[model samples]
Target: MEARLIPIALTIAGSDSGGGAGIQADLKAFSALGVYGASVITALTAQNTRAVTMVEPASCAMIAAQMQAVFDDLEIRAVKLGMLGDAQAIATVAAGLRGRDVPVVLDPVMVAKSGDRLLPTDALTALRTELLPLATVLTPNLPEAADLLDTAPACDEDRILEQGQALCELGAQAVLMKGGHGRGPECVDLLIRANGVTRLSAPRRATQNTHGTGCTLSAAIAAGLAQGMDLTQAVTRAHAYLQGAIAHADGLGVGSGHGPVHHFHGIWPNG
Candidate 1:
């Protein structure tokens, strides 16, 4: 009898010591979706829900080595990029994954919930020129989109669609414009691809546990893609998973600041 094969997803991102966002969140999301998760840390931050005090980036050589090691062994079906510290790291990641035939989900993680900048301001250009073109799906919140576009993000539906289109024009095969930062009764996420734009809407849940929402959503999407779902199906599953996680995020008692969503909300006890 042949042994069963598991879908593998790789997350190339920074490490959150607090275990809320970045690699920790990505791995949790992958596991919840039944995907085997691998990681290549680009940086390490002394961070918690409250603030990020210090950050130390890994050498480009080390980053490349980690990625090579993973790709050499495991059959990675999807990749997620998150919280790359600088232009050099971004370039390293792009070079490492340039020819890989896998869906790449790029989460433009800029600022932490505690108001600390994750990606340096100087690295924005590298993200645009080097990384954007390589992404299969670019996931950015309203503020992130604004930063990338160097313009005010639209709040209304019309403007949001325009922004989504604009992001797609930046060279990503698809763009998922997250609307949690936008003002509305419902959170509307726009997925723009070559085919068309898709609107995924969910009721806004009043919760402070949104620390790792972006990372988790992107990771979940990667997991879905690794599991052989189409782009639309993957996005839909990810949206549903995020909604449930946010809704069930009541009292984990993690930290004083913005807490983390229940990553394993689907399988947790009494979830």
Candidate 2:
């Protein structure tokens, strides 16, 4: 009898010592979704639910070496990128990923849920020039979208659509403008592609344990893509998965501040 083959996905991001966000959350989402997860650490962060005390970035040589090692051994089907810390790291990652055939999910992670800065100011230019064009899907919250556009956060639906379109113009094959940061009864996420735009809306769940929402969502999308789902199917499933995770987050009493969402909501019984 032939052995079963598992889909593999790679995450090139920073490490979250808190075990809630960054590489930790990405791997959890991948595992929960049945995808084998690989990682290339670009930075190590000392953080928890409360705040990020410190951040130490890995050298560019090490980052490139990790990428080469993983790509050499694993048949990576998709990739999810989180925090790269600076312009040099971004350039290195972009170089490593260039010409690869796998789908790329770019989560422009600039700030932490605890209001800590993750990516520096100067890295924005590098992110735009180097990574955006390589991304199959770019996921950014309202503030992140604004920061990328160098404009104010969109408050109205029209502005949100405008910003989403603008981000699509910026080079990403598609852009997922996350509405989690918006003020609304329903959190509406827009998936803007070349041909059309898809709107995925769901009621905002009342839960403070949503620390790794962005990371988890992007990782789930990568997992879906790794499993061979199209863009709409992947985004829709990822959106639904993240919604359930956020809804069930309170079940796990992880930290005092913003806790992590239940990555294994389907597998684990309710509290």
Candidate 3:
């Protein structure tokens, strides 16, 4: 009898030297979800929990070549996109993904965990015009949603649904507006599509190790999609997985700010 083969996922994002977010986190999530992961680094960042001290965007041609190299050699079923850094990078990625009929989970990563700008303000228009339409799903936190739509709505369930609708109008197939930053005891992530809206709520874990939550969640979802799960199931499983990662966070005191979640928590034995 032959053994089963897992699907493959590609993450086109930045490199985090801290190994908490960006491509590092995405690969962790993919591995945890039983998917083979490949990467096309858009930029390299000198970052830690506290802040991003430096960032270098890979040239548009180089970025595209890396992506081509992956697709040329592997059977990539899904793609997760993060920190594109600039309009050129965004356009380069969008063009590379245009004809590929793969599920794409776009984590509109505009700001870092330390509140530093990752995507340039001038690139937002290009993102909306070129990338959103091609995205299978767009996962944006409160601030990113507001920036994309140009309005900050109250963080209530009703307003979130409205904002999700507005984002859908911008041409995304589905919009997941995260409520982790919303003021509440429960972290509610809302998924809105032409079919309807579903709100997923989980009690907010009291931990500082949330550095890569958004990126991890999006990558997890992409992994699920690659494994043939439906949208709602993918979201549910990803959320549960992230909650567990947060609960088992490693108390790595690397910085005074947020730390990385324990990506290998349940899978590893403590020494």
Best by TM-score: 2
Q: Note the residue pairs that clash in candidate 1.
A: none
Q: Give lDDT: candidate 3, residue 141.
A: 91
- Writing each residue's lDDT as its tens digit, candidate 1 over 49-133 gives 8889999999999999999999999999999999999999999999999988899999999999888989878999999999999
**Per-residue lDDT of 1-271 in model 2, one digit per residue for the tens?**
9989999999999999999999999999999999999999999999999999999999999999999999999999999999999999999999999999989999999999999999999999999999999999999999999999999999977899899899889899999999999987989999998899899999988888999999999999999999999999999999999999998899999999999999999999977
Off by over 4 Å in 3: 1-3, 250-255, 269-271
Candidate 2, lDDT over the whole model:
0.95
TM-score of each: 0.98, 0.99, 0.96
Residue pairs in clash, model 2: none
- Model 3 Cα lDDT, one tens digit per residue, 15-70: 99999999999999999889999999999999998899999989999998999899
- lDDT-wise, the better of 1 and 2 is 2
lDDT for predicted candidate 1 compared with the true structure: 0.92
**Count of clashes, each model:** 0, 0, 0
Cα lDDT listed for each candidate = 0.92, 0.95, 0.90
Over 4 Å off in model 1, which ranges? none
